[model samples]
Target: MPMRLFNIVYITILCLFSTFVIGQTLEILPPKNITTVQVFNPQKNDNTAIIRLGSNEYLLFLFDDLEAGYKRYNYKIEHRNADWSESNIFESEYVVGLNNDYVRTYKNSFNTYKKFTNYQIQFPNKDMNVKLGGNYLLKVYTTNEDQPIFTKRFAVYQGNVDVGMKSSRYINPTYKDINQRIQTVISSGSQNLTETPDGGKLFIMKNNNWNEHIADINPDFTRSNQLTYNNVEWTFEGGGEYNWFDTKNLDVPGLTTERNFRKDSVYHTVLRVDFPKYNLPYDDYGDVNGNFYIRNNRFGNEYLAASEADYSWVYFALDAFEDQNGLYEPYVVGAFNNWEISPQSKLKYNPVSKLWENEYFLKQGYYNYQYVVVNTKNKRVEPSYVSGSFWQTENLYQGLFYYRPWGGRYDILMGYGEVNTRN
Candidate 1:
């Protein structure tokens, strides 16, 4: 990364003040529940990690990089003046665990398809702690001599979930909104996909809620696209919850094991984003005047799962009313940005009402996103993506744990991620 880029990210961390708290960062969070993963190297010693306002529980992490092995990290929030300084409350080195024998086979050109042998590395049993305040960091390394391989940033609330008790913030993170749909539904499809020699083939709702081009995606890198819905007014409220249900709730065996503790499993609303249908069908497949997505990484634990690759794609539509330059504006946000609405994906404003429009092509699966206004006053936000929700891809989120430490049962959450819509 360039010095300027690093500087820009840290600068934004300082500026992330949330209406709910002292401040916040808008980055995608990691999957809250993951049991199995393949890390590249772990035999070596001296892997250190750092934290800002540390916690008293197990590690709070963004889903690690599958390619590079976990620890690519999120900046989160601002504290102690919001600078990366020591007083900022959070910052430190980390002790990360790795599963070395995660690969199934090595398909080298030499006709050697060897199963990745198990190196017998172990996961941690205790919670990692960084006892301070303000914004902090976690840096994990192989050894003092090795370069820091994995990095994560988090904010310590010093409080609990019971604190935010209004507008569904405690349970769902997003609350009332102008564009919120009276009712919304979402589901997932598959993760292990076979790419056609021609293109990708992701399954989505029969309706045009997703992109036709998405069927052709087969990338190592992924992105989180919000699931559109109603009653979601995420205009700078520091932190919130986003719950994505698994498809098993729809009753497809072997696809999922999640059962609703309550009969209404689909009633759970996690994230939202714009759908292709928002625009009249005349637009080009590669055009959007304004649109974007947002994330919650600045705060603790909130992250983009599976490295933003295997998750749902976030889509937004800019104002067609904007000028020809509308497509050139910002239409996306979330943890991907440093938190602020970015110019790189801005919505090009229409000359009619001078409103802008934009769109995003995200990965398939489920997610939570905010429909922002972009301007400082956040005056340009849209509610269609917020309130007018839709259902797209249907993927299964399976959580398996090696509880015995060596060879325990792989416990998948019963009603953990079953995605569905309300009756």
Candidate 2:
């Protein structure tokens, strides 16, 4: 057999016999009772889960169980490659302490109509610590079950390299007004990166949405110790700012909320009807770029709000009669659902009202969302179909650099950086 084909077959067998095979995509697989899964850096006050290695920084993982009772939940951490596949290295090589352990922090909801038990865990604790800087996955599961309730992705970087990025209008004339391009440069300070053709990889994501990203991009130019990525294909849709509404207080309606009422002993918030922005000019009203944080305006303490905040049924209506043909399906997407399309977020057409409507049971917080369409034939998600695209739209772009020396067992996260279009 050829050398390359033999190596490929060997790797496939190794992955199959491994403890677990993380698929190509990073995703969350929560059951029906799970909601509001969030992983973020508490100190940074943002949803991005990238942290520096060997620093005091930690990533916070929070989720709520609608079952409303305490349960014995355990978590396990696994190292992954830049492509999100299981790494070839052993757990002991990547983790300094126990890789699997129990979650000791939880709280029951207080003074809320909807009953729930919130579970939280912080990483790099005494029980568990990651020694290697690379992609990692946190899997939460029942004490006795091998199947995970949900899995989340986070990254650790060594900061050994300096990564810089700049954004501008796309070079293509046809997409110049509707798309934005990013150019990246990585300076390897002291690390000796392999000079092989396939030794390094770069990934770029927009607005911290891992579901949609550009991956496996090689540097367009290489210098003494610097790599540059100026490819024209590194362009993303400059979708308009996310539509936002506040639900910090259940008793009082917030801006963009049409009404708030008590129904079935629970609060219900109806947002004003929305319209397509394809033809409308860009509106830079400022938004969190499709992120949300739990808050209860009635309380003075944030931690108190975490447990005291109530859940409500939020109603959304989009009047897109012109775009509501049988060829496309509309979905309301945001960070609440990890920006993934699910059955609950899919809007149904109401013939009587001539609108697309859907409702989500969400915790008390301010949220940003937008309407997107899926092409029926191609199963492609088009954010610009309903939200519109413009070069002036502000966006947060993140760049990650990964390196794997020749004959290395796994990839190492050497550098991480962010760039904002409005900056």
Tell me how many clashing residue pairs each candidate has: 124, 0
What residue runs in model 1 are displaced by over 4 Å at the alpha carbon? 1-56, 64-128, 139-153, 157-316, 319-328, 335-340, 347-364, 373-423
Q: What does candidate 1's lDDT look like per residue over 1-423, in tens digits?
A: 112111132233224322112233222222312211222112221011111123323332222222323322212222232222333221232222221112221111111111111111212223223332223333333343123333334333222111111122212323321111121222124211122221221111111111100111123332221122223322111111222222212222112222212222212112222322333222222211111221222222112222222222122343333222432123444433223344444555456644444433332222233343322332333323322222221211111000011221211111111112211
Q: What lDDT does candidate 2 reach at residue 328?
A: 80
lDDT of 2 by residue, 235-274 (tens): 7878899999999988888989999999888999999999
Model 1 deviation from native, Cα RMSD in Å: 20.6
Worst 10 residues of 2 by lDDT: 1-10
Can you give the lDDT of residue 139 in candidate 1?
Answer: 36
Per-residue error for 162 in candidate 1, Å, reads 10
lDDT of 2: 0.81
Best by TM-score: 2
